[model samples]
Every structure is written in C-alpha cells, then in structure tokens.
Target: MSADAQTAGSRRSSETGFAARTGGGYSGPMPDITIVYEHPAWFLPLFTGLEARGISFDAVHADGLVFDPADTRPPAPVVFNRIAMSSFLRAPEHPIFFAQALMAQWQAVGARVVNGADVLAIDANKARQLALIAGLGLAIPATRVVHRAADLVAAAATLRFPVVVKANIGGSGAGIVRYDSADELAAAVADGNAPDSIDRVLMVQEYVPVRSGAITRIETLGGKYLYAIDVDGGGGFDLCPADVCLTAPGKAAVSVVQAHPAPELIAAAERIAVAAGMDVGGVEVMIDDRDGTPRFYDVNALSNFVADPVTVIGFDPHDRLIDWLADRIVESKA
Candidate 1:
C-alpha cells in the first residue's frame, strides 16, 4: 500500500479504541460525521452547513482514502458520501473504485452512510440509471447500450436521428456526442473520433429536445423534495449546478426564479431516489418537445444545489440538508 493508504489504515486501527470504549453503542459523545468526498469546491457549502450547526465532523478526501476489508467496523458511525462521478474529468488520478469499495466497507459495519454504496454504484453507471428510470415507470428517451465501437453503427440504427453517444460512466457530460445522422456516427466510428468510453461501454440515445429550452432539476434531502431549479438547456452538457460550472463560456446560467416541477414529476423524482437507494441527491428531467411529457434523464447521487439557492429557489437547501443530517445524527445516537 502507498503511504497515504497506510496512514489511513493506521488511523482506523487506532479508532478501534474509541469503539471499544463506547461498547459499539452511541452512549457517550456523538461520533464524528466523516464526509467522504472529492472536489473541494463542490463541498464548501456542505462544510459551511455543518459548521453552522457546530456539528463535529471530519472531511476524508476520497482521493487518498484507504480501508481494510478485514476491519469489521468504520471508525466513524455517520458517513456522508460526496464522492463525485466526475472526478476523473478534473484529475488523471481518480478514486471512484476505491470510493465504491470504501462505501461498501462502511455499510458492512453498520455505519450510518448517507447515500450509501448502492447509490454510488447506480450513480456510476448510466445504463443502471436508465434501468431505474424505466423501472419507476417514468418516461425515458429510447437508448441502446454497446460494448464495442463496431457495435455503434448497429445501435444507432435502432435510435432516431440526432442521437447522442454517451459513455456509461459519464459524469458532468464528459463523454457525450451528438450525431445528426447515421453517416456522421459511422464516420466518427471509422475515424476513431467517437467519445472514449470510461468503462468500454456506451449508450446511443435519442436526443429529446426540451419543450421550453430548459431542463428542470429537483433536489431531494433524505428522500424528500427540498427544492427545484431550471437551467438553460441551450447550455452545453457540463451542467453541474455549482456556481463555478455555470461560469463557463456558453454554459447558460441557472435561472434566478424558483422552478416548481409538476407535482407528478416531483413524485417521480422522489421515487427515483428511493429506487436508487439515495438519501440525498438530484433528479433531472425535461419536457419532451414532441410529446409534452416529462422524461427523466439523469440521477445525481451527489447533488450540488445550485449556487445561492435562497435567491433562486426562495430557500437555502444546504441548511435544510444540514438539518436532516443533524436529525440522522441524533437518531443514530438514540
């Protein structure tokens, strides 16, 4: 193991003493709530939320996290997972696999993991996202999954024109390309110009044009609706709700007005969260221009509420999120 991994292992081992002292119960002081995550900027609001409540917590950077399978219990009782699926886009070295393993480890030991391992697994796979969407009886654009570049042509034949080829493991719109014609897709495949797949898997999906040139994203906390916002659909794909992402050139800024998704759409988003085993996250849906039906497209296990939500959505979701966390902490102790 690397030095960082060794240090993390050592730290967990030492914390066994605290576990022993508490007799595996939440009797004494509350255990620290460890935030396992990547991307410092995305977590600033979350950090602020915890600090505002004077909650005892620690940030464990997932980039260097290490967990021993032999260790039967997590050092911390409450773990909030904030590992982004898009980490690979920012850094050559990503800890997605390591983070997944660590989440499983935490769950095995009965740690109160918010947005636990199952959600992480679903969030990392777009095919799984589609399956969950379809399972929830929600509308989804027609899509086909392919494992080889040679299969792209055949897959595109099954979808409508102006299809998008997306990497199954895509995050923040990293590996997505729109092809207006089969000839265009074939040309890209022939020239090795196709978007490289992170997991050697791709999805050719029909492009669903938005009805209002905007896509609605609903944020949920502890499996309930917190707020919703609409982002300009004309904006290119890297639609991370963080203020930094919105500043990119050609990226449409988030609307300052609160967006109330249809009541049915809100219910569907909540069901999607429950189906994916996510406690906190966002669900993205757009009204199809052709049918006027809301089609659920993306399920974000790690939700970064749009920047300055109070101004846009009439309330600060992070404060509400922290309230949920505080309740979980108290419940864990009880």
Candidate 2:
C-alpha cells in the first residue's frame, strides 16, 4: 500500500472499538469528521475549534471534488458538508451540479452527513425555498419566479412597488437589485443594466421595509436551537456572518448582537430547519414595517457563526458545535 493509505489504515485500526483520546494528548485515530467545503476563510473558526479539541479532520475542496458511484462506503463515517451556494462567486468554473450529485451519492450510501443532499438542494434554489416557506405556513415576501430577462419587467408588475430582483440561486446576496418603479426596471432591462442571474432564474420580490433596521438570524445545530443574533441590515445585500467578508468597502460593518427570539419565532425557525433537512444552519427573519409581522426570508443550511462569539454572543458557539460533532461521531460508531 502507498504510505499515506497505510498511515490512514493504521489510524483507523487504532480507533476501531475504542474511544478516541482527548485533552491535547490524543494518540488515537485521526478525527473521523470530513469537512466538505469551498470557502477557506469562512471555516477558520471550525478548523480552530477542531484543532483545539485535538481532533484531526480531512477537508475536501468542493471546487475539484469527485466521487465514485460504485464505492458505497466513503472514507469517513461522518461528513460535514460545508459547501456554500455562493461558491460560484469564488470559482465560477466549478461544477456545482456535480457537487449536488456527490451529496446525493453520499446520502444513498447512508453516510452520516450533516447538511445532507436535501438541505443543499434547498439552499441552492430560492424558488424551492419560497415553496418551503409557504408550505410551512410561514410569512414570506410577495414573490414571483421568472426564467427569461424579458419576463423581468412583467414579473415586477405583480409585486408591490420598490421590489428587488434576486437570483433564483443566490448566495452572499448576489444578483439582487432594488427597483423603485416598473419603469426603472424596464429601463434597466432595455439598457442591459439589469443583473444577470447565475442560474438564469430570477425572483421579483416585494421589498418589505424593515421595521427595526435589522434582521434576526436564528442558528440551529443537530436540528435543535443553539442561539440567535440580530444583524444590522444597513449594510445592504451581502450579510456574510464571517467578519472578514463584512469589511467590504461599500458595505457597512454589520453589528451582531445576541437575541432571544419569541416562542413562535423559535418554533417557526426550528420547523423551517427540519423542513429543509438541515442539521446545522441559520434562519433569517425581518419584521415588516407595514404589518409588524415577521417575514421569513432566507434559510441557510451552511452557517458561519458570527466572529468572536464570546464578545458578540457571550459564548463561543464552536465549542458547543465541537461537542455536538463528537457525540455524532460516537453515535455513528454505535
């Protein structure tokens, strides 16, 4: 066997039928957690958390990921899928469809994958997200889905004034533009100034004025409530939770404050997470100025916890995340 394969086999053998060592002196098998992801910066906290716990994990780069259909059992017993829908912004040439196929393959083989294929599907398509929102009886923005640019103007007419055209498959708030009037949207389309959707699908959604100038993001882990944070929305579209991305030139630095969502909101968020088949994720809700009712807008299966959790949210969420993952690993073994 090759040297690397031999080492892996040795490590796996050591870990079999035994509890892995901990407390910085771990000599057991390497971490069984395999993180499949695209962005590097967003995952630094998770990597740090794993290292701090003396756990070693293998990272699969989504840009060049591959899978063999015939190989039913993957290398890791537990895989944490961290692939972002916004990955197209970083690597436009990457095959996102292939990533989806691979996730489905992983599920077929019964791999213990967090944020599995179902969540990835919902995360990639906004139309599907809207359907899920409506199906769950949650309040969603008045929205219309369109395929061709010619339909953009017509679609805008159906929604209220001051509507936003968003990409059907959007991430980091890409391909979203606000129009004050239908005439403005038509002019943009005529001048070819309208943003092109990444997947050629667009959603014209009514712009509900924020009542508090902020939105609440409730995060869940292992299908249970973990914590919630409020993000100032004056920063515009891109509201990446990672601090590094929050420093864009034109984008205001978003302030994240811990929040306690109402019982109904908490229940609603949990229901959405379950409906989306998400194991770890965040749900965004904004109260409409017109009605004072909370509107569920975004559901994310991949969560990058706000930076400096202790200072921002009063505790480090990654610590709890690590514990959850460890328990999951142990359960998989059983």
TM-score of each: 0.89, 0.88
Candidate 2 deviant stretches above 4 angstroms: 1-31, 248-250
Q: Write the per-residue lDDT of candidate 1 for residues 77-195, one digit (tens) a residue.
A: 68888888888887777877667877888878877899888888899988999998998788898999889988999988977899999988878778999999999999999999998
Point to the candidate with the largest TM-score: 1
**C-alpha root-mean-square deviation, each candidate:** 5.4, 6.0
| lDDT (CA) per prediction | 0.77, 0.77
Model 1 shows how many backbone clashes?
A: 0
Worst 10 residues of 1 by lDDT: 16-25
Show where candidate 1 strays beyond 4 Å: 1-31, 248-256
What TM value does model 2 have? Answer: 0.88
